[model samples]
Target chain A: MATESGTSTRFRSQTADFDAETGLAVDAALAGLDALDIPTTQRRPLASRAWAATWPKIGALALFLLLWQLVVWSGWKPSYVLPGPGKALSEFGSRLGTSHFWDALARTLVRAVEGYALAVVIGVVVGVAVSRSTILRTAVGSFITALQTMPSIVWFPLAILLFKLSESAIMFVVVLGAAPSVANGVIYGVDYVPPLLVRVGRSMGASGFSLYRYVVAPAALPSVLAGLKQGWAFAWRSLMAGELLVIVPGHPSVGADLQNSRELLDTVGVMASMITIFVVGVVVDAAFNTADQRMRVRRGLVAEGTSAVRAARGSRGLGVAGGAVDPVGSSGDGTMPPPADPGAGGGDGGHSGGAG
Target chain B: MTAVRSDTAVRIDGVSRFFGSGAARVQALDNVSLDVRSGEFLCLLGASGCGKSTLLGLITGLDAPTTGTVDTTNRRAGMMFQDSALLPWLTAGGNIEVPLRLRGIRRGERRERVERLLAMVRLAGLADKRPHELSGGMRQRVSLARAFAQEADILCMDEPFGALDAMTRDLLHDELERIWRETGVTVIFVTHDVREAVRLGDRIVLLSSRPGRVAEVFDVDIERPRRIDSARVAELATVVTTRLREEVGRHGH
Candidate 1:
């Protein structure tokens, strides 16, 4: 590895003979990465993101379990009222093979998925529509915000009355709760899209539906995905609330099962149910977070070494000095290192070359 | 008055743009008339709030002049901005091929055009790289390629290289000269940088700030690929700077 002085010396030598034009060019070449270094404050990777990626959310679970145990041991609440981890695990084991528990879990999962999928489709479509139109944006934007502000649980009663206590009734409440957040996410994403990007799209002859398909949608994806995540939270909460209030004879949703387990003074069963809900939420959230990070990485938003290296390469092409890097070594891809020197300045910068 | 109509690629006749009405009204441009020539590099040099960009917008049909007619027979006009306004989602090649894609060019033709444009801008291997993947200069190069891909006869650039460092800007000036020579396209470049104006333009047109009006027009008899350090370029830059300073001083700033 080059010493620190060697690196600085190399940079100085590279640009030593540069004219005003070349000096500006070299600076411009490196200008893109002016703010790329991760801030010291953000140097520590967030566990939330890491937990969302790896299947080992077990660490957090262990901490949570310890906290629960502490709460019980410390007599924060009556042991009988707030069951300990051991009681909850025992309760979970007892219900593992039971048909009621399996059916409740399946039913809740299916309804949540249904509500979530529906919300994503409608939310993205309506969101794009509202965001694109001035009148619609002004008129419906506030309404969507208001809907998000209202708790999904509040819609449970109205939805039951409207759909008359069917599966669709519960779904209606879930959809109402989740769709608004998703729509808002998409709307906000589109709203935040840089005006310059939109202008670029227009110059490229993108207009009408093509404009959104090509520019607006992709640009708004991060926000749309965020909305989807939020939508799921809303959907999950709404489904549980709907199931708790609207009773079905054969089908007991997780929420209803929790209530019934409580009615029978089975605190362990209630704890088990709560744990299941928490686990599912965690899993779904992890999935969304993973997908979002992957997308950002693909878009080069992450401050990974690969990007830093490429940035260094760009400077090299402009005849700026870079610290000596292995010309052909193993890259992150586990293959031969990417082309180290594409012969940028020799000529034919006007022709097809892989250097840039 | 009305000298050699054929020399003009753009005709902004008696153009006046006003915002709001009555007491709250502001006249952005008043009775502005100009003729931008065919295949000539013209710089619209002005200060902030001078409506130089507005004039360019009127020429490009992005916005209409409230009280005048901008008539240009050319059906297509290309525009560049200071921000480099590239589509972050699209790869450099994909962004370059956008105009072709919109025009219903076949996939093969689109690829060919994109490749050619990328080559022209010296950004060949960046086909798959998104805007964020490239450095600022590279992004601007991609933007330049995109503008060229429009195949417009006239190119209107509003401080296209403003955000770039001096070295990159100068390098691009050389690249732009090469491109202009290769393709005989008319250019209307707007910039606040007088040295840039002197270096890049065949004709420099100055606009006074606030309710912008044409102040003076100077023909830059400088040769191609004009060196920034060259005596001629420096002399012209100095003269233009003095004129600009005097104009600004009239506003008591």
Candidate 2:
């Protein structure tokens, strides 16, 4: 054995260079470990991944349109009262060229964004308060979840009574509808953080606020994201309901357009406005999904692509895949490594084919 | 309480731990005592319910004994759990940086230390990769690096290689030995496998199950640079295995 260096205050920086013979052995072993690690997937290009994600959604949209056209062909209702897919598309296409249409769309989008932002803030505050205080959790925990299950539209009458038929009226209901889910999400995340992580953090001398900030909070993030996604959906539904009922004369929104089209018996305009609402919901949901998937990838909760649990269990993760490792008795040999699979790295981007 | 030498990294004096109360009382450990010498590799060996991990918990201060004292001289034990519980959000380098950052080390030093630790674990250029991007062995390696990043005098591992396959475990044994030799850190390793204890430890403290107590302590006098499959290691492992089986066999009575 080397001379006993009893104890030191700091960790030494010279493991691989400890002795001439053993140092070389460590290096060779490390080289073999380096070779065994291959890419998680076939490493498809970025365009392929993007295409893979896009094509399925496009196909779904086409199938829906086809079904709508078939329903129109069946003549379930009068042609004037219920327009076909062709008529709705033609109306929608015609509206796209109008500055009036763009203004209404922009106003609706701005309200949605601002209202959702307010809801998130409320949710975070309520969530943190409920999570931090046992009394709050006991008093309001079940109530928060109860509020989530109650239809957001049910809040409109109370919201209008509280704030009148103004922007505040719409925002009040939106916040009420979305904040409960957000708070519950926060509470659930805090409750379920793995105890092992907490122990590891404490063992490393992280305590008090530092433990919560570095360990607990980050561990709770994935759950929090799920909450936020669900919260946004609620806010969207609430905003849509509020817009229809409490439309101010100045604020031209999609919901207000639907109301006007119905009042005027403008069948094409009504179909076009409904289609716009559907598109908005689809787009926002897609954005949330993308955010959730990216976060999951970062945590290794999912593999680089799909099949994370399998990848972890497979030979690529823990086994001797390419070759056996017995380099102990070899003489004067630091084998030049092939770095295992060269193609696993060279391919642009990765196989994030999104289960499309 | 029992007295300890100045060089003793950890001392457990008549430590016993009981869970619940009255008829429900389960004794996890019973008057188990041992001293870990500074910079030595000591293995706590037993079957399940032997309180090997419970003893480790007392040493690390994650738990306290219902009776007796665990004197660690105010030094904490950096523990490695069986599963590589790396924070999913952070990169591999970022996980190592957590302890340093918590200690309020400056940014530049933290970065430098992270690079060094990653390199020490033979995970160079994988600093940006998250836990999922790496394989099972790689995740464990990063976990080991994160443990060292805590800068503790004693590294207490609780079946850290249990999830890994044989080859990966063997690789980590080499990696761990080299790191231990270089750093001179005391290791209070817990494992069920007799061969594993022989492969890595300088000393093995065998404990009995269903109310753990120190059964015997064997000095692993095998020479350095010993392989897991080496004849001397297997021979000692055989002896330890028989003793361990005898202890385990007592439950049938």
Candidate 3:
């Protein structure tokens, strides 16, 4: 009994030592990750990281404004044609205080949102149909590609002819412009889902709709997100064009504002409206970028955290290869030492590391 | 080890499988017949393109035989592939929960079963980890747990450990053998490795390529906990390897 108790005490101490060793190794590995600008499990506060990301964008905008001011100062074009940056800025500031400007912005945004939602529904249905059936894919696949490449402006005339310069005309053109790209994205995503995953799903008794839901959809998500981003670009551009062409009597949109500014020879208003459109595009694109980045980081497809940390690590010449640090923490877990054969463990380690 | 029961877990009779048609047609399996006894660890040993995996497909109902029959008594068969095939989106525990969810097991039961399976595979505390975050061996272990979670009477493994390093493979052999012994589930393991077959298989059936057919069947009388490098396993492997080589030689012409 005494010997057994002594043995138990010894085992407890050994376990304690092993746990301490593992803790040290984990700390060291996390430090190495920090040195490489790779985030460990617990990252820094989100707000600071977001601020770190935002500053560069702000800098780029400032540089863009400086460039615009220099171009205006060069006197290449008359002030009537290309307004000075200060003139546009003052127009923008004044516009921000006006209720009419906000209403116009809101109207344009609502139309774009409605059109985008419709495009998503149409694109997903058509894409899934074409992807599932060889006949549909063969017959309509090229047609869809052709449609995507076709100038969206071509659809505007038909849309206006059908709806007679109404909001419906604008929405019709927006849907037409975006749906093809979204469908193509879904098709490509479904086509490229790893065959092995499908087989695995099948082995688990997943069939038909369940198979698509549990396996196909999730696997195709990254590509689908890519397509959605592309589709949004098309939708946004088409909406702007539509608003410019099809002016409803009471609805004052950014696109309508551009046309009015052009007609009235308010060059500063036109430039300000153009800047607003450009900023809107950038802002929407940034939203999509953030969503895509989050998905990529979650999948471990890309590294997370601030580029400033990456640059700092780069300057230090640490050159620690990504995905090399053992996450299992087995190196220091003495009690659960890796498989008896070092060669075997080493080979698998190399393989998984390279794959990651 | 339990006595090899007379009751069969899987039976394949006069099975022939052909892929494509006319000019492009290629026969994958021809007149292959076999019976896997209940609670037996049977290895389907063959060369590349020997239809070992095709035979597994037939048993698992992933593919139907063009001629003849593969009867698993309509019982669902679990399968593990060469790759881990764990869903990237799901965590290790979530992957295991897939089959349980499919089988319509209650949420409470699924959670309990997933934990048990994870512990069985020695991957406890790794439930929340993504497949990419884990080692290859760990991922494979998760895959194994996923297969076992199906609770099928028969488990078909298609060279599941072929991509694993030797040490990991050896460790897994021990784990699989222990699991098989403990659960008493019938296992039909397909592999090209003769030592692995000898190490794990209670019965080894050799197949020849070019319209794969059963070339030989050897009853492995080795005791439980057989080591891959054991002299007894080596002795049996030599005899099986010689027959396997002869089968491969026949295809050389």
Give me the overall lDDT of model 2: 0.76
Q: What is the DockQ of each candidate?
A: 0.18, 0.35, 0.15
List the candidate 2 regions with Cα displacement exceeding 4 Å: A1-18, A37-39, A132-134, A303-356, B1-5
Q: How much of the true contact map at the interface does candidate 3 reproduce, as a fraction?
A: 0.23
> lDDT by residue for model 3 over B36-153, one digit each (tens)?
8866789999998999989988898888999999988655589998878888778899999998888788999889888889887777777898765666667788898999888777
Each candidate's number of clashing pairs is: 4, 0, 0
TM-score of candidate 2 versus the correct structure, residues matched by position: 0.85
Candidate 3 whole-model C-alpha lDDT, 0 to 1 = 0.76
Candidate 2 lDDT tens digits, A1-356 = 11244353233444334446676766687677656763344555667666656676677789999998888789998889878889999999999899888898998888888888887888888888888899988998888877877777777778889888999998887787777767766777777677778888887888888988998787777567667766777777777788888889888888899889989999989999988988897777667656655655555444434434445455332211211121111110111111112111211122211111
C-alpha RMSD values across all candidates: 14.0, 9.7, 11.2
True-contact fraction in model 2 equals: 0.46
Better by lDDT, candidate 3 or 1: 3
lDDT tens digits, residues A82-123, model 1? 878998998888888899888889988988888888987888
Sort the predicted structures by DockQ, highest score first.
2, 1, 3
lDDT of 1 by residue, B1-253 (tens): 1233255678889988877899998877878888887667889998887788888778777778898899876446788888777765567888787888888889998898888888777777669876665656667778888888888767889898898777668768866765665566778999999889999898999888778888889999986557878999999999999999888888885
